[model samples]
Target: MIRARHAGVAAGAAVLLLLTACGSHGDNTQSPAPASSTDLTHLQKLVEDAESAASSAESDMARE
Candidate 1:
């Protein structure tokens, strides 16, 4: 029937509208600057220390 066809069209339009509304509202804001050289070096040192600790732990576990 014509009414049923119109109802289907209206339902489809509602779904489309809901989907568009739910789409991401991404901001155009700029990200912060990259880390400075000093900060990067500190981070590198921390990572190295963590890796060394992990290796020591594994070695101890193997000995046990």
Candidate 2:
């Protein structure tokens, strides 16, 4: 399980790396900054919602 999880993560990272290395030939003058606190906060909210959904699903399954 651990190996599978690691492999999955590695595969995702490889994809991201490939995309980054093969940059677009267009102008990047309007690109957003790499890191932003607002983005982090939004991601945190998304994670919370996902966890809540998972918990709700588990409870639903338990009652079935």
Candidate 3:
């Protein structure tokens, strides 16, 4: 009975140690910079151009 209790405690301790080692704390080290106003403007232009081209292609296909 005593040996069984020791084995249980050892197993529990091993599990706790493994869990603590695998946990992640918040990572501020590699966080992305917030997009600047210039970046947003460039992205908006790119998206608009892509959508316009897609619409033109779809319109051309519909005419065919």
Candidate 4:
């Protein structure tokens, strides 16, 4: 009976340790940088140019 009680206490302690190990203790409250209108416009232009270049490359590869 005492052995069983000891085993049960050990099992409970193991479970508590596992739960504490799995918990996130770091600060994750940082906010993201807000994007401005000009930044969005620039990013959009860059994406458009990249897409145009990719399409041209694909067409050239098909012709080869």
Cα-based lDDT at residue 60, candidate 2: 65
**lDDT by residue (tens digit), candidate 3, 1-64:** 4344444555555554444444444685354445556755655565565555556666666787
TM-score of every model versus the real structure: 0.52, 0.48, 0.51, 0.51
Clashing pairs in 4: none
Task: Looking at model 4, report the run of 10 residues with the lowest lDDT sum.
Answer: 16-25
TM-score of 3: 0.51
Across 14-64, the per-residue lDDT of candidate 1 in tens digits comes to: 554444435444586354444556755655565565555556666666787
Q: Where does candidate 3 clash, by residue pair? A: none
Candidate 2 lDDT over 1-64, as tens digits, reads: 4344444555555555445445454676455335355655655565565555556666666787
RMSD of 1: 23.6
* Best of the two (1, 3) by TM-score: 1
lDDT of 1: 0.53
Better TM-score candidate (1, 2): 1
Tell me how candidate 2 scores on lDDT. 0.54
lDDT of each: 0.53, 0.54, 0.53, 0.54
Error of 1 at 18 (Å): 35
Q: Which candidate achieves the best TM-score against the true structure?
A: 1
